[model samples]
Target chain A: MKCPKVLLLAAGLTIFASVDSVAGDVKVIANASVKADTISAADLKRVFLEEKSSLDGSHVEPLLEKEGRAHEAFLQEYLGMSEDDLQSYYQTLLFTGRGFMPKVLGSDAEVVAYVARTQGAIGYVSSAASAEGVKTLAIGVPSSNAERKLITRVEPDYPDTLKRLNIGGTVRLRVSISAKGNVEDVELLGGNPILGESAAAAVKKWVYAAGRSRTIAEVSILFDGR
Target chain B: MSTSVTDKLRVGAQLYDRNLGQLGQYHPSLDWAVADYRFKSWFGVRGGKVKTTLGLYNDTQDLDFLRTFALLPQSVYPTDLRDATIAHLGGDVYGSLSLKHRLGGLAYTAYAGHRSDSIYGGVAYLAAQYQVYFSSYGGLQYGGDLRWNTPLKGLLIGISRMNEDVTGKAKAINPLNPGAGFVPYSAISKADWADQFYGEYTAGKLRIDSEYRRFVHDEQDQTADIVLVEIYDDVRGWYVSGSYRVTKRLALGYYYSRYSVTSVAGGLLAPYAPHQTDTSLPANHVYDKVISARVDLRRCWNVKVEGHFMNGYEYSSYPNGFYPQVNPQGFKPNTNALVVKTGFNF
Candidate 1:
């Protein structure tokens, strides 16, 4: 009788723990017109992080809820970034003249309202503020602390105007993606004229598996003397 | 004249320009500048400069002080040395001038003048060339030379006379012995001799320059007429050539030439042969053709290897290669030669 009671008590504790985890801290919302029957965790991450710039040739813009428990959880789980790191990344991009951070609204209600008005807007809020105006999405939780994989190569019909004299140098790039994965701006840190355009073009088509549907990424170009 | 290889090496740039390219009895200009330095025990280097002009031509007496008289064989003399043969058949000697400065960030060199022999109305030349560069892991260049620098780039055009003699004071004991006879012309004779080779007025010359993306140069000279062995010999003509880069590493070039010469002498030696003595042949005239290809490959940092081939008519001189001469014999001027060179710049 004693053993049975102990087992029952342990089972009750486990149930309560699972319930707590099931109640998500933040809720992601897309425009009601978003016609996807179901979005994968990877696709949701791509949308919010700016990795995917467009959907069906339509521009995708991401919105952010102002700082709060829900905003912190969303960034940490879906973007795989701490609040401090995300701020620092934006600061770097802004000073370099690459692009700006996504627009932040004061409340979850504001995010929902913006997404409702915009054709391809995306945002996140606390589950408590979830409502009918915005379609809720399940963004993927980050498995590890690493940058999301984006674009790999540019198209073949690009110009061959400049001779690529890789005289041995490094180039750093910071990029921001829209929900549909389009690179809007680019900044070159250190490189000759040859590699700048190619790097930018390829980064624009990057599709992040982590952001699901949103991402911002930084890359380092290494020139190994061949 | 009485030095060994080691002794010559010890004397350095002094002897190299002395015996080399010894033309006829024209006096060659004598000039030399040498400097030696020794800093601490770990470093030592030598610097020197010398320039000499040499060529074969008659002497004129117009410039009495700079005359270049000739030395003929004992059997062909008109009694006195002055009246001997009374022909301009020797080289001129014009002195060479050079300067070298190697210190700090400025290393430079400048050269001017010549050395040759000629008599009566002889020619005098004023020339100079300069270059300055740095000496580090890699070298840097920022100066230009203006003397006898034919054409190494772009389009190559123009006639250049690098051969001239300067009448020297040294005299030889034997006139027939090659090394025994020293230059036999006075300063006037030397100047006259120099003048003959360069002063003899002629519209065409050995020249090279660039045009558009092509490089071209041509050289023509009228030698003496041949008697008996030929019907007509009044030599005169021009050899022209052009080169174009087909690719970054490859190039193609072509050349054409026409030469003519009078086979006979005009004065006393005319009766032996009628057509041979005719001056109507206008000296010399002949036709020629040539083609060439060049290849350049990158080897290392700022280093490149180059190779080229040239084939054409009457384009090769008897002694010197790039200079063209009119041939009396009706022989085709077809030659094939290959060359390889490596270059480095910083």
Candidate 2:
């Protein structure tokens, strides 16, 4: 008749997103004290979910933006859970003694400032936000046995009208590569359907190193107003 | 429910419904508490009242906000047993070890403690069937659990073992033979033990889990007449469940649970037959099939509706909510129940 008390560790690393875009496409930001320039999407989700406290030998903590397009974008592009689901999930972790609540800051500026001041803080911000004091960390494939194999990078185009009206967020596209290292196909997974079309068009020009077999990669692009 | 005392130390406690018996009103008491310190992931210590790590969902069972079902599989985690089953007074050594490479990680907890059962719980209700009333029941307990977060994503397996030495004191009055007066006795179990095995798998929005457990108890009642009554209870239970998130706000779940107890009485324990063993008695088993749905009502709240189809709870030596004494009208072989529950967490 006892409630089941369990001593359990969080499950293994989660495998997620791939980094293929560059420059103004930056979206994830980490404190300068963090050692890793690029973090696997799996580890990003782990840290944000409070599954693991350190990444690449550096102790790190995750911060959340209270709400907005950036917050929704981060949840969709990385954690893959709704705001309520995330909160309920956190409550599970808390009651189980598996995790503690990470600080939540309102707006991208608050997150940026907090991350800049906190030595091991990591958070997501708008692509339009200035990456002045914090370091932008690229999300990569942790399951791959090799480093980045891309030979050509194509930047997604942001429609002027959408950018001017501040209607900007993250767009995800599934990119297929042939065994011969040529781009084969691109399909929109999410984001504004129109922005998805432009993101897909740009991703189609991407080139990867030849592999033993055709490789499928998920690519995320940011169309920022700035 | 929890607060940080320092960067490395945290403490918390819970007090809730605590209805010890059917006739007992809701009594609030400190259910569980702990002062825990995590020096490292692989090494930590906790003191005060610690929840035992048994099977799959024991510790988290009290927190309804985190589950899709209105009630867990009662064949194993019975809601009536919550009084003393939730925690023990003592300390624990625990940690999560990250294994090298693809082997994944292992988490473990080992502890020794004192268990104190409530006088107003199942013990009292079960005794009422035999005309005995207990003032207290408790003793020493120890257990541990080891789990492997397998290399395969979303797969986890674990085993747990618990042992206890319990003693209870009570007074019995013969209902028919009023002249017998009140007789005091003590029930002692030197070694009672339980073992459990469980596994859980998660893929996308769907989750599946299963567990099996066995408990053995041999107790002896000693009265001032020097008469000894031997009581043996062999309990077994198992359950398998699956739940899928059908939408952002809704989830569906179903589970089947089987529970049974074969009891033996000897040396006057059974008034009609001194040394009788009834292994296949109808009162000894309960099987259940359940279906449930949950809606995420808000950021910090959820509501669950569940249906239970239960068979064979004619009566029990443990009196787990089904007692012949309580149902003078007799019991139906099969019964169904609908439950709706909403909980908040913030």
Candidate 3:
């Protein structure tokens, strides 16, 4: 009986440790000049992804930590991209002259100092770091209606030439869903242009559960020659 | 290369392959070396060799990795006029303005500068007009463009206008006049203007693009002591193109393009038999329908195979000059061409 209690305690502690590791604490911080004290995850994603230059009527600039635990966690949790992928995305933006790379700092102290001095600056850091000069932002979770679920999906056709050549890869797409649950638009985030076309055609026919407003979704489809 | 001198100011330089002189031949040149200052999101100033803002693709044309098609539609982005339309040595003011509601934003650019012409221009002039190649060419050029990004995702509409004053000189022995010594002729000295409108939409894996352009040229000739000639040339072109991404590595595209030119006969040769019979030269029109398949072998490399069904003799470089008269019976109104290209860039 005593042995069983010990095993239960050990298992409970193990579960707790795993949960804490996976839910590592991180905080979004902004300069004093920023008007909003809180931001939604969707808007945070937009700002960090360079989709919007302003948030809640205030011009916003995003900063990045060069490479660290905070950087990795921020990318995985908020941006949903890897370090290499984020770098490539910025390169595309730079080459196209659509956007510029955000400023990157070496540590949480550096990030806080820069954000304190710069107007409209926003960044992220580990919860352990002191955000004395900057304002910590409360990130809001998306509402239930904002979570669109796909109800109908159509598979894309593989081109004969590509099949014969045994070429296969994953295509990533960004889809816009209307309030009525119809797919309003789709954009190729990364992929072969020919395969992107076929994937786009099929995605256009996809139907999603109705939402209260427009929702954006990111999806990946794979094509294997065989 | 670029470095920030201050929080708001930066300087950079770009060196790229210059192929406007001869198609498929690359020459190393500085594309832009500039100092840019941004005071706000809605306004900025850039000086040095700035990319021209004439159309949707001009600024990004050199970046192959950013484009969907291996070649932009050739009717508007003609290989022969690439250098003339790409950029200028000067300054530009650019900015963006947000619209009300979820209507998106408006982006605008205004620029001015002098542009150095290329051998391609001279070759095109000689081939089309008088089989006399110009050795040197240069010009002053200016342009502006405006784009509206609508509330609808991935939809943009734009308009652009440009003006240029060009001059060219060449010395060549006239093959038509065998005994004549080398004659020096001003191949081009004219004022040219162009206007264009374009729209693009991208959704899911589908992309569609369309554009229309018109060009007008006023020319004056003083090579002959006995006569001075004045002429006007009008050209129009448009294209509609669409592409689909079938998978991560393959995309298919199709487009239809049309081009036409009309020249008013008012030069020293106006009294010639046909010039007198027709006030305006016969309108030359060309049509091209193309289908292409592109494969992305890697993140930075792509290969494309394209087939073109071409109709009309309007694009025969010497449409009104050498070819029509040299091989009157050999002119083919319809033809086909295959283009295969592999491109890689960083």
Candidate of highest lDDT: 2
TM-score of each: 0.23, 0.76, 0.65
Candidate 2 Cα deviation (angstroms), residue B315: 3.0
Positional deviation of residue A169's Cα in model 1 after best superposition, in angstroms:
5.2
Instruction: For model 3 chain A, give the 10-residue run with minimal summed lDDT.
Output: A11-20
Query: Candidate 1, overall lDDT?
Result: 0.33
Better of 2 and 3 by DockQ: 2
On the 0 to 100 scale, the lDDT of residue A130 in model 1 is 38
Report, for all candidates in order, the number of backbone clashes. 132, 7, 23
How much is the lDDT of residue A204 in candidate 3?
Answer: 90
Predicted candidate 1, C-alpha RMSD: 29.7
**Candidate 3 global Cα RMSD:** 14.4
Over the full model, what C-alpha lDDT does candidate 2 score relative to the true structure? 0.73
Shift of residue A65 alpha carbon in model 1, Å? 55
In candidate 3, what are the lDDT values of residues B64-99, reduced to their tens digit? 555457667766776556676777888888877657
Candidate 1 lDDT score at position B316 = 16
Which of candidates 2 and 3 is the stronger one according to TM-score?
2
- Please tell me how candidate 1 rates in CAPRI terms: incorrect
What is the C-alpha lDDT profile of model 1 across B1-346, one tens digit per residue?
A: 1111221121222221112112213443222332322221112222342221111111121111111111111111111212111221221121111121211011112223332222111111100000101111001111111222122211212222222222222222222233544323211111111111111111122222221111111111111221111122223433334445455455454545343333432333235434433322322222334444444443111122222222233221111122211233533434433333333211
